[model samples]
Target: MLRQDLAAIVRAGFSAAAAGRLLERALAPGDALPDGALRVIAAGKASSSMAEAARGLLGSRIRGGLVVSPEPRSVPSPFEAIAGGHPMPTTGSEQAGRRALALAASLQADETLVVLLSGGASALMAVPAAGVALDDKRATTDRLLRAGADIHALNTVRKHLSAIKGGWLAASAPCACRAFAISDVVGDDLSVIASGPTVADSSTFSEAADVLRRFGEEAAYPGAVVARLAKGARGDVPETPKPGDPRLVRAASAVIGGRRDAMDGAAREAGTLGYHVVWIDDPVVGEARIAALLHLRGVVARADGVARPTCIVSSGETTVRVIGDGKGGRNQEFALALAAPLASLGGAAAAASAGTDGIDGPTDAAGAVVDQTTVERARAAGLSPDTFLDHNNAYAFYNNAYAFFAALGDLILTGPTDTNVGDLQIILLA
Candidate 1:
């Protein structure tokens, strides 16, 4: 029963249908468009759905389009769909990037270009700047991911290394352009969302270099990448367009969906389930395990204050600094860390943490669920959560625990949710 309720809550929170509706509302009719052809370029996990919404609204106006996603999905005939890579850029991603650039360049000054940007666009539409090999870019991205860099830091570096990111895509187009984004980063900063392909970038090459130095990964970066950043910082290479640049005068962007929308959806579902809802307004950030403990403390406090059943919902992306060679994502680590504290809460508490996109880190599982029985079940199976967590293997821990505690329904699996809004977490006290 607990598992069902939690799943329902998560589903309510990240429904692709709901996201499509929200996108439709954000791009409702009467939004001004230049009196010419409309070309669409959609990229990221939510690209297909966002394109579909755009099609519904501006069907006849959309002349041709392209969408780049981690996997192919059915899209309108006018829009060519290509499968790209995520977490790392692949040859297909390079091809998609080239196609996007060509499409953008094809636009006349009288035409309009609509870019649907969302999470995963950074890798899905990879286009390295001159002199940076794809392999080098991939290696740099891998190092950054392993080093547990936040999205902002990751995009800061990515924008500098890319030919089409950080407003370059917008600059290439002579036509009027607008980008609608489903932000996965904290604060919904346009410059960081999918590297802000159609928006002006305020970050600089020097700042990108600083991010590498701050993360202690500067030495590990590919030599060519380091050289490129250094050159750009020294003004040997042009910087990404900044605010008020003429290249960005015709470009505009709006965030159509994000963490706040997902949180509200979850809150409404919790209330409908007869639980008093407490919304955690602060965005959850930092190391996954530490954030888990902090979130547990908040849950306990809320539980103490309420007489009736209560539900707590919080949203934000968290990082897992990879000290352990374990195979898990931030959401998995978070759920694992919560097990002990939740077990201490006695029998009336259950909690869940999951990525809204349905895939957490490199693992197939979105995240995990835990209750008082989780820790006990692990013991019965001769499993040590600490040992698994120490190895950074939350996926293995949950996989083993799920085998022993099948009734607990600990693994939350929703394949390729096709939308990203960071992550959503819920704690229920009854």
Candidate 2:
């Protein structure tokens, strides 16, 4: 029953129909460029699907462009494959970044640029700012991830340090541009997803400097990098295309997919299963353990006096502050923390959690599902959830208990889901 419920939640969010509809809304037929007017250039996890949808809408009128994503074994017409890194920047990311830049620069003055963007675009479409080497950007990105910085903060620093981010791509285009964004950030900050290749950024260099001071590597930034940011802050380097920038007057953007969509899907499925569903807002942030506690509190509040089964559905990215020398991702840490808490609550209700993408952190498992039995089981094995969490080993804790859940048990793994809209978490109170 527990597995069935969790599976239903996963299926609800990832359907061919919903994905297609989102693509249609993101690239409405009328929004397509006029005959021989559009040049498509895109990158991200969902770029493939988004590109396919664009080609479908535009047909022979579409001008071909490059797309960077995890390798799609099955080729779709009109989408070229350029595999790149995710969650971590790599050398391949650098190559794709350059290609994206060259493509954007190639747009004719009379043409329209249609860019397909989503999460992972930052790394998959990396183009370092003037003085920063690709390696430097990679180092900084890795540091930010390890530091547990949220997407917005991490992207702020990334935009300042990259030539392609912070609306630089749009500004560089020789023609009007429109970006179709699948927002993974909580608030759908256009500038954060892939560092806002098509949208303007409001964060200043000083702000980026402050983020570095707070959680970034100030000394690690290349000397030239530091000077460029300082210059940009002083209005010399050109602020990322702003609202009224002539270039953006004809440019537009829309978020076609996000945590909200994921939650809505889960809620509908849960409702059909005779479970009361409660969906929190999409942008929930903060430390993973604390977030887990908050989620548990909500469930407790509803379950205390209710007789009908309840399922708490949430979709958002959370941060995990890595302190110990352990291995796990934010989702794993969240599940481990929640497991102990739910067990302590001592109810008949079971719990399940997962990353919709089927992979969390460095581990292969998406996340975990626990019930009152998890804590007691772990304790009997002389393994404390708290101890594993302290060591940043949530994967270890949950895997040993036979509770970790990944899509199709990771055998049918889609690797990186090409598109990221944070995470989908469904906590069953039945």
Highest-TM-score candidate: 1
What's model 2's lDDT at 414? 35
TM-score versus the correct structure, for each prediction? 0.97, 0.91
CA RMSD, predictions in order: 1.4, 2.9
**Count of residue pairs whose backbone atoms collide, per candidate:** 1, 3
Q: Where does candidate 1 clash, by residue pair?
A: 326-392
Give lDDT tens digits, candidate 1, residues 40-75: 999998888888888888888899999899987788
The Cα RMSD in angstroms, rounded to one decimal, for candidate 1 relative to the true structure is 1.4
TM-score of 1: 0.97
Give a tens-digit lDDT track for model 2, residues 285-342. Answer: 6888888888778756755665557777777878887889888578777766777676
For model 1 the local lDDT of residue 386 reads: 89
Model 2 residue pairs with clashes: 45-418, 45-419, 46-418
Worst 10 residues of 1 by lDDT: 400-409
